[model samples]
Target: MLEGHQLLGFGFFVIGLWHLFNHTKLHALGSKSYTSTLWFPTTISRYMELHFIMASCTIFIAMELFIAPIHHQPFDPDGTIPTTHLHNFEHSSMAMSFLVYAIFAIVLDMKCTMAQHELTHFLGAIAFTQQFLLIHLHSRDHVGPEGQYHLLLQLLITVSLATTLMGIGFPKSFLVCFVRSVSIVFQGVWLMIMGFLLWTPGFQPKGCFMHLEETEEYVVKCSDDEALHRAVSLVNILFSFLVIGVTVFAMSFYLVMLRRYGGKVEYVSLVKEEHYREEDGFVKPKGTIDLENNMDDDESQKKSMQE
Candidate 1:
């Protein structure tokens, strides 16, 4: 199977082509909020929903990656020792993350579950990391001498994973942004370290497959191999840009929006209170009672008038 990067190149090509021919329609999907619509009922909230999906998908896919073949892929592409421990750790932690979400969901009653909130961050990191990994794979750096079939498959996985993470619904909030940013850092650092390890002098494939060499690298790298690689590169880039770039980019703007709307609401409330105070200079407090004072005042006034 294609490891990861090759799939990204393929996906990028398709997305770019889609926009070249159908940018107008795609733009509309983002331009307006549809209250009656499931996703667009409130555009921001809808995006939050999307972020949740991406996060959940990220965890699920990561889990799936670990489940088969070896029943779990080593985090390392280079068959490095670190990959095993890291992958296992992340694998075990996933169950904990699941528990956290389950508890959060049970305790709170909100439109979104805790998993969705956490996912926002988890996915954000993947957004950048995946993009970097994918591009690097297609570049001179990550590509390898493998079967074309495997190359394309890897390319597909990378793209699909990136596409899934950089999806239409990433949230504009810090929750998602922070997670994504971190993911970005981790993805890059991890890949770079592994890429270095791949070339390390001591590194040797312990498996049965490393000694074999194909007629030509079966891995169809878009950079040197096929139209498919170049074709998908653009969209994958866009996805990277959209997912990581947008999440990071839109943060300040979201803060500004929060301040703007919050100020308006506060201002309106203040104005209404001022209006009421001006209209009724000495308004009685809510639930205020003066049983003794009121009764004594009434009797005193009555006695004086009679006298």
Candidate 2:
């Protein structure tokens, strides 16, 4: 769960930064209302999305390969899977999926031109889809507030997937981008809540108790109806917090964009010819020539001939 939270929190944070830098223009920020477009101002800026994803995936891979091995044995020496390693294996698999997408995105960025952004969007959706499935499949056995939290997280992951798909179809839609960013932010916040509430000493659900054996991590189980109610209320409060956090981040980002690029002209690709220059080429050449120069040249030629 901690790994899940950290992965999602950092991934979305990077993505939020990418969207702020790449997909947005300061001109719209300064306006009372602005629409978003899919293109970025510069070629390098256009690849920020992939860079963030790749970086996040690298971190996940590192965590899985180095950090995780220290804590959990993912497989038995005989090559049989253990019940204890199920969670670890699931997380590792999810990380691998992100790594795959990141590598694919980087390759596309370097070698491919058409549908690169669209493909990235699809890949992102696939990554989220993997998480969504894991949460659904794994949480079925969880019975208490922990289960509820996983269910909520699954919903957010679903939204993340949906928004990514929508982004692929309507890459220019500002609303889609905004929703996607907010969804991710919400996921991160919820992950933090889960980490604190489920694992921390003080924040466990009111009606539930955690049991830990010598060989296993703690598992939460509900003890009474009243505790369940308290846990549900706590979840409700956490959701309210998520909403507030997203609102604050969005507003702050808007203000920052407005202040930065508000007055500048829209940035264009340096490689492409300007529209005005193309239009200039269509103008007809003048019919009036340098008749005086032509006459003088003619007279000089005739004088030479006579001489």
Report the number of the highest-TM-score candidate: 2
- lDDT digits (tens) for residues 66-177 of candidate 1: 6523636644566663432433343334333433433343333245565554453344334434433443444222233222222433443454354435433543322332
Per-residue lDDT for 183 in model 1?
Answer: 34
* Model 2 / residue 141 / CA error / Å: 2.0
Error of 1 at 97 (Å): 14
| Distance from true location, Cα of 121 in model 2, Å | 1.7
lDDT tens digits by residue: candidate 2, 159-277: 87898888877755766777776677677767766876787666676667777745476776667877877776777777778778778887787668756766657766743544565
Give me candidate 1's TM-score against the actual structure: 0.25
Query: Which residue segments of model 1 deviate by more than 4 Å?
Result: 2-65, 71-126, 133-141, 144-307
Q: Report how far residue 305 has shifted in candidate 1, in Å.
A: 99
